[model samples]
Target: MPRALSTPPVIAPGSLGGSPQPVLPVTGGLLLRPWEEADVPAFLSAYQDDEIRRWHTRRPSTEGQVQEWFEAYRQDWKHEKGGHWAITCDDDAEVLGRIALRGLDFDDGMAGVAYWVLPAARGASVAARGLRSLTTWALAEIGFHRLELDHSTRNHASCRVATKSGYLLEGTKRSAAVHDDGRHDMHLHACIRGH
Candidate 1:
């Protein structure tokens, strides 16, 4: 018989009190800050990319929907449900991408990460840098024991980002998620504390 898994310590309330989200500095003068209403146009534009649409299950199609999404992000933070940030370059008003720690389970000391870089920002290692910065903060500042990042198995680019950011490829979740085209096998990657 296999041993039962041990329950991890729960994260304390207000541990993630950086609501309105603090600006995290990344390589190349990039910053990860809270999403703002003014960014809605850029957010909508980024989702128009076929690659973004292919990998992300949800894409807001209208300005109102995008605003709603931003509101939800605020609510998530206010309720301590999760954290989301817009990746941008210093001295620029446009968003380069987005990275988030979602599916938060304080009792398990775990959370799931997700990201998307704009087409213009692809091949610049922007995603990897943002992922590394976020993971570091989540583990060190927020005290999460484990962070998981998963992507469609077919997304080789994302696989590279995950590995480059120090996430180890654990395994695959067979047909774990449904895409617009069909179901996708997800490649599961994780970074555990003290690893």
Candidate 2:
């Protein structure tokens, strides 16, 4: 029989999602958990906004494309890889955003972080709490040595998120890739294990 999870004050090394996936209870102004089918409508609304599109890779995605993306999101958890979580309010469990570590590399001990919050949740502490919790788990439980995040140079809020999460400003990649508007400047940031 499988062993039951033990409570640890801090993240436990290699304790995230192996023998049995741990459901971390992270809270700030809100709480975070794995995504649910009920969150689809709210998730769609957040992704459809103009500003959110501007910061993401898909700016004007078709409904079909969005559905496909959503499907992939649903399937991510089942894979032997990383998964996304929905950020919900603490007072009322209304999903306000999402945070995830995609492209997980257990062997290499690394992962790339990504996140987004609904406009209503902006200025709230949800993002910070979610980012910190996820990072801590990835480094401690998942045994990752490095965690990296990227943002467009134009996205000041995203940049702030990275800096606030203790990621170092590595440098800029000039015209590294084209965006929906056919222009681009990317800012790369990273946080290493043990400070």
Candidate 3:
């Protein structure tokens, strides 16, 4: 059955300090939908970019690896785990970026978010809209209570986005993980649903 687009179950407008509406359809030159096999090439191209790879756990260095991840992305949605959508613009349908909800824990009412926009798409508010759409859907439709997003301490841009999007700046963990160069600090953000 196709998911109907309707006002989600229960989201108090004042929860986020404004009248929050359920996510609108893809507008403003961006379309977000589930991943497809053909999106492998686009995913590879996006992930391979040096700037994006800096925060990514592992970069897709080979076509075969990208192919595998692409398949896994499909399986994620199929198996009710978590996944992302290709951020395409309406004018050219250009796959300019991606936003994802991975590591879902349904029983605990939580999920982790990750996203990136091509450098060309930066400063265009694509990331904010993408995150809002996905998070609203996850909270109201998917019955999740809290959404979590973590970014490296040095990635101030991500921190600003998270805060601006109603995510509370929880705290920072020192030496939370190791990157290619050395230990990295992690800043965590979270949003809890309203009754």
Candidate 4:
């Protein structure tokens, strides 16, 4: 016969999917909130930017596709598969960027982090701020053990964001990521709980 478990799960089943994801606040009054119907336009427009499209190869060509993505994001959140948020400001409330924890492995107590900032939000440390806020929520607030972030080796901005957010450089994965330009090496970074 099999023996009963000694220790409980690190994250209870209902702990994440049971409740709504909260609006995480960043410095400079920036906030990370769930995407809404109103954000569809901005989300679509982001793909047209050369830099955004360069790294994020997937693009939503039409309103329908954007809406479909929103549905998928909501489903991911409901099932604890992922958590995605829109980075906005207190005064404007418009989408300045996005940060997400994808590929959540509750059993292993880890998740993958990803983010992008719009052109208007580029100069400020928006991505780093959003990343830090999300990291706190995922590690400290939710009790996850680690969060991993991977970006194209050529994406200097993303590397800076990960480093600025306290994600240590682990190593590079050769030809691990494919962009519209072509296959590229990926730099892996990680941040564990408790600083």
Ranking by lDDT: 4, 1, 3, 2
1-195: candidate 4 lDDT, tens digit per residue: 934557766777777899998888898899999999999999999988999999998889998999999999999999999999999997776899989999988776889999999999897999999999899888888999999999999999999999999999999999998898889999999999986
- Estimate the overall C-alpha local distance difference test score of candidate 1: 0.91
lDDT of 2: 0.74
CA deviation > 4 Å runs, candidate 1: 1-8, 17-19
Which residue pairs come into collision in candidate 1? Answer: none
Best-matching candidate per lDDT? 4
Clashing pairs in 2: none
lDDT of 3 at 109: 68
lDDT of each: 0.91, 0.74, 0.75, 0.91
lDDT of 3: 0.75
Off by over 4 Å in 3: 1-24
Q: TM-score of predicted model 3?
A: 0.82
> What value does the lDDT take at residue 195 in candidate 1?
97
lDDT tens digits, residues 26-63, model 3?
55756786566677778788876777888886788777
lDDT per residue for candidate 1 within 92-144, as digits (tens), equals: 87799999989887778999999999999999999999999999999988889
- For candidate 2, the clash count comes to 0
Cα lDDT tens digits for candidate 2, 1-195: 944545432334344444544445675555667665666667777867777877776542455555566567656655646677788776776988789888776555777998998888788766777888888877866668899988889889888888888889999989876666877888999989899
Task: State each candidate's clash count.
Answer: 0, 0, 0, 0
Off by over 4 Å in 4: 1-7
User: TM-score winner among the candidates?
Assistant: 4
